[model samples]
Every structure is written in C-alpha cells, then in structure tokens.
Target: MLQDHLLEEHAGPAAETEPALVLANAQVVTAADSFRGAVTLQAGKIAEVTDGGAIPSGAIDCQGELLLPGLVDLHTDHCERHAVPRPGVQWDPLEAAIAHDAQVAAAGITTVFDSLVVGLRDADQTRRDLLGQIMAAVEKGETLGLFRSQHFLHLRCEVTDPTLLDQVEPHMDHPLLRLVSIMEHTVGQRQFPDAEKYREILIKLFHVPPEQVDERFRRDAEASRTFAPTYRAAICRMAHARGIPVAAHDDETLEHVEEAAHLGMALSEFPTTLVAAEAARECGMATIMGAPNVVKGGSQTGNVSAVALVKAGLLDILASDYVPVSMLSATLRLTGDDIGLTLPQAVKMASLAPAKAAGLDDRGEIAVGKRADLLRVRLVEGHPVVRTVYAAGDRVA
Candidate 1:
C-alpha cells in the first residue's frame, strides 16, 4: 500500500528508499485529542502514535513542539501570485512554480490545490496565454519531484466566459486536474453583489478606466446571463464523470446554493453570503473559506465573514487562498484567543476536512496506517511558525 501511494518520481529525492523517521517527544495533536507522544514513520506510513511509549534511540527529538498533521490547502492562488507578481508582470512558469512550492512547503501545506485560471474572456488573453505553459510546468515539476509538497490542480472555470469548454478541452484527461469550480465574476452578481463596490474594485485592481467600467460591467453581466447556466451544467457533468470534485464559487443567494446542489456539487468555495453558506451546508455541500479572510478579519471584496461562518457551524474547510502562510496562522488563531474551538478542531479544519473535501483519504491525520505527512509547529510571540515538514515520512522542508 505504501509503495502504491508513494509520490511520483523523476530526478529528485524519492520517498521509496528514504529511511524511516521517528519524531519523538512532541505534543502530538490527533483527530480526537492532543497528548505528549511519539510518532513513528516507516514505509511511507505512520507506523505508530504512542503516549510515552519507548522511543527509538535514533528518533529525532522534537523537544515539546506542537506536532500536527500536515495541512491540506484546498484552494491557493499563491501559484498565480508567484506567476504574476505585479498586475502585468509575468514570471517564468517553472521558476514561479518552484518558488511557490518552496513557500507552500515552508508554510506547512503538505498538500495544495494550485488554483489556476481557466477562463475564456478575451479581456484577459494574457491569463489564457500563460495557462498551458504554467500547467505544463507544474506537471513537469511534480513528476520531477521538484516540489516539496504534493501538488494538484484546481481549475477555476469562468462559467460566464464564452469559450469556457474550449479552454479546458485538451486537458480533460489531465491527471492533476483533481477539482473544478464554477465561478462567475460578473460585476453585479455573487462575489460582486454590490455594483458600486464591484466597479471600484475593477477601477483599482484591474485598472479599468472609470468611464469604461459601467460598459464592461454591462457586457460581462450580459455574457453571464446568456452562458453561465449552460456552461455550469456541461462542465459540472464532465467533472463528475471524471471523478473530480466540483465546487460552486462565490455563492451569494439561496438560489445559487440550490442550483449547485441540483448539479451535485460536492463543495461550495468562498460563498459570499452567510445565507448562501447555510443553504449550501443544509444541502450537504461542504463550505470552504479562505484562511486569509479569517486572518484579515474580513474579505478584500467585502464579503461575509469566514470567522462568522465558523461560529455559525457552517464552515467545513479552510483554504490558503492568496496567502500561503495564512493557513497555519488562521488555524492557530482559530484555536487561540477564545475562538470557541479547541486546537484539534481547528487543525482538522485545515487538514482532514480539506483532505476529505478533495477525496484524499490516505493523509490529513496523524494516525497509524495513514501517510506520515506531518508538521512541527512552534509558537513564538503569539504566532505559529512551521519548523519542519514531512511528506510520506521524508523530511522535505
């Protein structure tokens, strides 16, 4: 089983021949509780987790640092952040992906869903131009073992775009395409529920001329109304057939949640309103929120609060979103400062919850028979910092 699940290999270090690693004498956080324990890793699996058990003489002593399951980030646009540093500056695809990998691993994300843009809007041809090259680079990087963390692709499909299917046609059989999300960023809907705020965001981030903002919004709204429904249905059906989880993005209204439920969406990514999130949960769809939103105390685009959703018993998974470091920070914060949840609960939200959301059951928990993907975190000055990362028992960061 360990051999079957070992990571893909090429030129870099492989877990197959790596010797067993034992992280002993740490405060281990498991799914059910936390204890001063030792974890044994061998054959790419967690061999044991024992409280005050006999430690191997060769074990690496953790010295009471917090040892937790490696975080699983369901959505991180940090790849795109590295690919495009400034608004218009494009970096080398391979270099950006490598840098993103290091940042992600160092941030303690052992498994990450790289949110790559898949849109057909002519308004952003540059984004489309980089799509193929970037994705290829990511695949090559992974196969070559260039990334410390396990990487997967999360295609953020722009349902309102005219050539949405065309943009994804060739990659239909891509192995890394584990997730697909239906999203519409049309100015007046969902994510941009308020037209004025949407216009301001466009003028600021997108550099849209104020005089042309209304025209662009109107055009996008028209495109959304005409194409979104059909594209959503078709793309969702294809994703379901391929065994890839589909998520509805920026859900705002009850109707949006109902539509996503009808289409069999397994998750709702970044619902913009509390009502939408509640509706999604009621329909049995897992709700995913950006960890950055929790750390920042609000959304950049003025959406419903993630922390509020967590308090309401609606949030199911947490994604790194735009900040790789936000995952660990948010988890610690959510577990700290009288946030109503214990450390184990918050860690589950960052790890097992997201792993299950992505249909990965082999990892995400510090338990016997699970992949030995783990992290050693220490708190200093009221902040959580990742000191070490292990992927399948191999120390990668």
Candidate 2:
C-alpha cells in the first residue's frame, strides 16, 4: 500500500480555474498540417481549430509565432537533478517536485514522466532512500493539483542490481506508475563500450580516486554481467504482466534490438547506433532519442548522432532527457532544410508520437476534444523561446 502520510506531508495547492483561451495569428502545427490559424480552448479541451482566420473576436494575438501541441516527454531525469541538486545535498521532496515542474513547464513540457531510478548505485543507497519520498511527493503534488504539467512515474529499472525485483515489487500496483524501462548501465556495454571513457565519466560523477576506478569497474562489470540477463528478463515479464509497456534502454547493436523486440518491448529508448534504431523501427518498436543530443549536435557518450537517424527517417520520437527545453528546439531543428521535416512533422515527434508511444491518447495534439495543452513559441535570435504555455486550458507560464 502507498504511504498516505508521506503524501499528506507533501500535498500543496488545488487546481486553478481555467479560462477560455484563443490563440491567434500563429502558424498552428497539427499532426496533419501547418496553417495560418487560431486554436480555441474551452472547458480544458481544444474547442476549435480554425484555418486562416481569427478565433471569435477576443482572440489573443500570437505575433505570428509557431503554435504547437504540448510536448509529452516519456523520459526525463530533470526531477532527479532537483532531488540531489549537488553532491551530498538532498532537497526536500515536495520542494524538488515543485521546482522541477516549474522548470519543465517554462520549457513548454505540458506532460512529463518523471523517470525515477528503481535501484541505487551507492553504498549508502541514496536513490533507494529517497525514491519513496520523492515518488510520493510527485503523486500527491499532482493529485493535489500542485503541478502545472501533468506528471506520472516512469521507473528506470536497473537490470544489473541484484535487488532490482525487491526494490520494484512495492511499486507494481502504484497508480502513478505508467511506464518502465529495463536498463543495464554497467559500462563497456550498451551505452559505454569504451572502458577508459567510462572510467573518466564515473570519476566525475562519484568524485572518486583514479586508483579505485579500474578495480571498481572490473568488479562492478562482473557483478552486472552475472545479474543483468536474468534480471532483464524478469523485469520485462513483471512489467508485461501488469499491462505496463517496457522500453529497451541504450540499444547499441542490431542484436540488441532484435533481442528487445523478441521480449515484446514496445519502445526503444536511445538506440546508440543507426543500425540499432533502424532495426528497432523495422521490428515495430518506436525509436526514441534524447532531444538534447539533437539540439546539442551529438551524444556526450560519443554514441550515434540523432540527426543522422532523423535524416534517415529512422527516428520516431524525441525525449527531453535532461533538458526539457531541448524538445522544442530539437523539433524545430529538424525542420531546417538539411533535415527536411516540415514544422508539423517535427512537432509530431515531440508531441503526438511520444504520447502515442506511452499509451496516452487524450492529449498531445490540437485536435478537437483533446486536452487543451499547447505551446506558443517564437524564434528569438534563432533560439526557440516559449512565449506561453497552456495545460488543459489553464495558462501556467
């Protein structure tokens, strides 16, 4: 059962009253088309999408900006950044949740899945210790209508953790739990096949001595390899039994893609190579890449380029990953002449495609009867700045 006391302690405000909104003088990008139009919001849903005209008479002028559907982020670690703002510092769970929501909202993410880790990598079990409190705060805050954007849980299950099942067992029935992904970030595999680079990255993250890096890597790798395959299979089965879609993380090769498809994985999160992404797409899995990778030009891990995949028409969706603002910027980048995606097509990857991948049908587009979540955006010095954000007819930022 959930800890209601934790929720009560974290609960904040209630939902605000929504005003009927009319977004006018913008290029409305829908799944089907981009046109000079206006979109009307009433009762928390899009009431009308008018092409080449103003909406009624009280429409708010958008100054010829780009109007896009609210972005749906299937995976994000930005919340975790709030939880542990820095090394040895843990912010209050409720405070962290609220702060994270505000940041993402300002970045035009109207719907986000807070991808919390299910296992801890530290000796003190920092993540395990904070997981319950943070997750409770998220659920309670959203339920109490404290969040501007809708929030749900996306458990990033660590397949190498021997206690993975035990850690995950409690959250199997969590109503807030919407998606799960099996991950094996053990280094020298999947996302990191370069041992030296992995060591350097680990040193920075843990602030550990160079002397301890090699020994720790060898030991951890052995342990992870011994446990990963068994735990991955079990995690997939449990997630499937609960009717939750499971995603494969950091796929690097065709074999990895094939194995994920064989396990009935619904989404491929961050395929590390073009071959893997293409294979996943051919296998009926949606290929998701980090929006930051696209916006920043390439992966920090030196993996495959997202733009390369997009150019090949192999990329299906773009996740905000660590930077919520990257979703919009990456989508916009894909519309450039080199990328060749139209405004509407690129917006679909950030909004509609991600929502569909995560089994969300009520939101993610500007169609009639859909949730009135939209972004009023403009390019200032070639950077996409969110002028305003509306979630369910309520202007929050």
Candidate 3:
C-alpha cells in the first residue's frame, strides 16, 4: 500500500508541485547491478529507474558519468578541524558545522556521522562544554534545511578520561546521537602502541613540547587506569538504554572484542589486529575500517592494515575516518586495478555497508522506497569528483 501510494503521489498532479529531477544517460550503481539507465527523482525519493531512455521534459543529461549512492561516512574527526580552525582558535559552532557539512557534501557524502571527541584530560572547561553547542548547531542546521547532508552525532568517548561520562550525560537523549564509540587512548596500546610515535604525533599535531608530551602521557595514563572501567560501564549502560549503537575503537585482541561485545557494542571501529577483527566477525559485530587505510596502503597509526583485513575476509564496512574524500577513493581502490569489482559491489563499502552498520535503513542505496540520497560522480584521472550531491531528493552541492 505504501509503495502504491508513493507511486500514485509521485505520478499524479503532485508532480506539478515537485520538479522531476530526471538523470539521463548515466551509469547507475544500483544494488543488483550497474546499468546505463535513466533515474527519475521526485519529492526526495527515487520515483523510477529504467533502462529505456525516456527523457523527461526537464531531464539533465549526465553524459555517461558514474552515478552511485551517496557515501555514508560512519566515522570522521573532520568536524574538529572546523571547530578548531587552528590550535586555540575556535569558530562559532554553527559556522563550523556548516563548513564541515559543505566539505562532506562536496566530497559526495550525503550522510555523515560526525565523530566528536568527548574526553580530554587537560581540556579546558569551555572546550568540554562545546559538545552541546556543536550538537545544537547540527540540529538547527538540519531543521533549517541549510546543510547538504544528513548529519548524525557519533560521540567518541575517551574511556580513560574520568569526566567523559559527565560530559555526555546531558546529551545522550538527543535523537541525532545515534552512535557511541568507546575509545581508550592510553599511551601503551590501541592507537599509540609505540610511545615514541605517540609523542611524535602529539608534537606534530598539538605542538606540545617534547618534555610536556611525556609528562602529559604519564598524567593521562594514571587517570586512565583509575577511571577507565567505571567510565566504560556507565557509558555502555547509557548507550544501551538509549538504543544507541555502541562501537569499540581500535580493539587489539580477542579479549578486547569479547569484552566490548559482552557490553552490548555491536560494531568494532578500526580494530588493531586480525584476532580482534576475526573475533568481531565471530561475535556477529560489524567491523569498520578507515578508507584512508585502504588508499594509503596501511594504517597511519601502525596498526593492522585495512587491506590485509579485507584480504582475510574480516573487513565489513569502510569509514572515511579523517578524510571525507577518501570514501569513494577507497571504494575504487578496493575494487583492484586489473579485475575490479562491479560498481554495485564497489559502492557498497561507502554506502550500504556503513549505513547498515550504523543502523540507518532509510538511505544508502538507490531504490524506489529508500531516501533519494544520491551522488553524481565522474572519474577524472582515476580520482572520483563530485559532480552533484543530493540528500532526500534535494540538491545540496
């Protein structure tokens, strides 16, 4: 009945109110296949997809460009770059959100799970308070129809930080808070297994003095040891109660994956070893890896490579992580050069896989009943460029 109603509504005089966006002569990457066809979008959902080229009155000729489902980035810290344009320099939350949205949209991401860090030992009170402000701005922008993509919050909780639970308490009720990633950034494991590499990254990114880096790590380690267990338990309970999808970040061992799975986390984000990824698969948890890892040939943090995981059949979904443009690039890279995957399979990592992992079923594919979140892209010199972006049938970029 719903499908019938949608067809009738889309085909009837209501079409006069809603302009039909007919994409013609395009290679459409649908779930089943990639075919040269015409797609008609009306009222923010796909109205029809047909092989016979029946050009509508106001059709836009794609001229054989590749059209794929809009990328759904499951994890990214790109918003932090906008919030803190430069170290110690802050922009208005709304402005930062808008800028981040524009960058993501231009990169062909129609849905973004903005990873906002919720814990820092030495962070100022104002910095901790900024999370609510940022979430509010995202909500306002979405409601106002000012953003190009649908934005959701993925609160990255530093399990080692004593104050993380407190910081997130008030905002757990927010509807946009769909995913919670428990991260333990202790100096000895996960991301910074090598302390020297950790110090080097700190100096490069945060500009911390060599002496201060060691001192900071020592202080943070003590705090982490003291507070990690309790903080992790509280956040897990809260997230579970709220029906939020919980993920464990950089899990390194089978024990680590087991503990997270027992705690009700259904996703493993960037597990550092094959043991952990395999354990996640066995536990029926979705494993998310970074797209940059696939494109750049390895993990920047010296963890297990995503390509290796994929080779072992352990990789489930790919997130953009820190690079918005890398989603499409990594998808193409995964398809291999000589005998690449079909477009449908290649697009899945950046679209349906991430969406299914995040429990977002309204979009991430081209279908009659799904949201009209789509992207028109063209490969230029082996790189994917966003020609146009649409979220719920509205052109944003």
Find the candidate with the highest TM-score and give its number.
Answer: 1
Q: Per-model C-alpha lDDT, please?
A: 0.87, 0.86, 0.84
Question: What TM-score, over all chains together, does every model reach?
Answer: 0.94, 0.93, 0.92
lDDT score for residue 112 of model 2: 92
Q: lDDT score, residue 204, model 3?
A: 94
In model 1, the clashing pairs are none
**lDDT tens digits, residue span 303-329, model 2:** 999999998989999999998888988
Query: Number of the top candidate by lDDT?
Result: 1
Model 3, residue pairs in steric clash: none
* Candidate 3 lDDT: 0.84
Better of 1 and 3 by TM-score: 1
Give the Cα-based TM-score of candidate 3 against the true structure.
Answer: 0.92
lDDT value for candidate 2?
Answer: 0.86
Give the higher-TM-score candidate: 2 or 3: 2
TM-score attained by model 2: 0.93
